[model samples]
Target: MGRILAIDYGTKRTGIAVTDELQIIASGLATVPTAELMDFLKDYTQKEKVERIVVGEPKRHSNEASESEKYIQVFLKALEKQLPDIPVERVDERFTSKMAFQTMIDSGLKKKQRRNKALIDEISATIILQSYLSRG
Candidate 1:
C-alpha cells in the first residue's frame, strides 16, 4: 500500500508527516514555507507513493472553526485541484501545538532546540498523523 501523508497547515509554515509504506508508523517529514507547500507536495508526491492525505482542521475551545480555517480552506481547495487523484481527510487539531511542546520536553530536547518553531510544526504534523493512524 502507498503511504498516508499528513499536513499540519500554518500561516507561515506547514508541517508534513507520512506513514511508512506499510502504513504502520507515522514520522515527521518536513517543515516547508506555506507559500511553497504546493510545489513541495507536488514534488514529494511524485517521488513517493501517497495514497491519502490528512489535514489538521483547527478549532476553537468551543469547537467552532478557528480563524485559520479560512486559510486552510483555500489551501484545501488548491490541494484538491492540484492532486485530484489523492483523497483528503480532515482531523480536529486542538491542542496539537501544546502536545507537540510537551512531546519535545519528553524527548529531552534542550531549551534552545525546543524554541525552534519549525521543529514544533514538524512534531505537530507527526502527532496529527499518529492521531489519524490510531483512529483506524
Candidate 2:
C-alpha cells in the first residue's frame, strides 16, 4: 500500500506528516509556508507514493466548525483539484497543539525549543496522523 499523508493547515504555515508504507507509524515531515504547500506536496508526491491525505479539522467547543474552516475549505478544494485521485479525509484536531506541547515537555526539550512554533506544528501534525492510524 502507498503511504498516507497528513496536513495541519494554518493561515501562515502548514505542517506535514506521512505514514510508513505499511501505515504503521506517523513521522513528522515538514512545516512549510501556506503559499508553498501545493508545490511542496506536488514535488513530494512525485517522489513518494501517497495514497491518501488526512487533514486536521478544527472545531469549536460547541461542536461547530471553527473560523479557520473557511480557509481550510479553500485549501481542500485546491488540493482536490490538483490531486483528484488521492482521497482526503478530515480528522478531529482538538487539543493537538496542547498534546504537542506536552510531548515536547516530556521529551525534555529546553524552554526555547519547546516554544518553537514550527516544531510544534510538525509535532501536531504527527499527533493528528498517529490518531488516525490508531483508529484504522
Q: How high is the CA lDDT of each candidate model? A: 0.96, 0.95
* Candidate 2, pairs of clashing residues: none
| Model 1 regions more than 4 Å off | none
* Candidate 2, superposed: residue stretches over 4 Å from native: none
lDDT by residue for model 1 over 1-136, one digit each (tens)?
9999999999999999999999999999999999999999999999999999999999999999999999999999999999999999999889899999999999899999999999999999999999999999
Candidate 2 residue 46 Cα shift, in angstroms, is 0.6
lDDT per residue for candidate 2 within 40-101, as digits (tens), equals 99999999999999999999889899999999999999999999999999999988999999
How close to the true structure is residue 60 of candidate 1, measured as C-alpha lDDT? 97
Ten-residue stretch with the least lDDT total in model 2: 115-124
Position 15, candidate 2: lDDT: 92
lDDT of model 1, residue 29: 95
Please state every model's RMSD to the true fold in angstroms: 0.5, 0.6
